[model samples]
Target: MTINIVVGAAIIRDGRLLAAQRAEPAELAGGWEFPGGKVDSGESDEDALVRECHEELGVKVALGDRVGGDWPLSAGSVLRVWTAGLVEGEPRALEHLELRWLGRDELGTVGWLPGDLPVVEAIAAYLG
Candidate 1:
């Protein structure tokens, strides 16, 4: 089986990370996750990330340093997580049902998609 590759973004501002809730349950449904989506055909991971950010959050992201990346679970899907700062545009939830800023303390408060837990830990490690 061909594993799906996804590019996820961890937008940090004022020490808080931006997370979005999936509209419904599927793999990580109802769980809070980084705002991103699968990389489309003919699109590089970086390009896909930029597009996903604009399409999902309505914000322009300057792909900062890559903080973390991994292929967790048996789906063979790879998760590329990056540290990005908002270049322009205010965040308006485009596809996600809701969005919120989560501080380190509140990070564990929300329900995270199973695959996201490792990504979250990586982010937490990078922040500190």
Candidate 2:
């Protein structure tokens, strides 16, 4: 089976990024990751991010830069991550067990999903 996961980094005004804790376990259980999920077939990347963000964080995003493109996870899952700004609604932990706003220095404090460490670095660079 092929698993295509599209993720997004909702960067807040304070230079912190948003991450969500997965509610299910296949891999990276209990670990934090960028807020996003699988992109439906024929769905645009940005569209997927928007939908996923609303579903997971209860917030609407004003799309920002494409910090980077998709990268393959060690689990063979592909992730499409984007950089977005908060537009409307406050971020609430909906699907996730918890949600956090993490600064670059604080990013390493969380137990991130397997492939998300690299993504953190990439996002940090993009933010700089």
lDDT of 2 by residue, 15-125 (tens): 788878877775666888888887889998888889988888888887777756667875767777778888898989888889888777787888888777778888776
Candidate 2 structure lDDT: 0.78
Q: Positional deviation of 1 in candidate 1, in angstroms?
A: 4.7
TM-score of each: 0.89, 0.86
**By TM-score, who's the top model here?**
1
- lDDT at residue 113 of model 2 (Cα atoms): 81
lDDT of 1 by residue, 38-62 (tens): 9998898889999999999999998
lDDT agreement with native, every candidate: 0.83, 0.78
Clashes of 1: 0
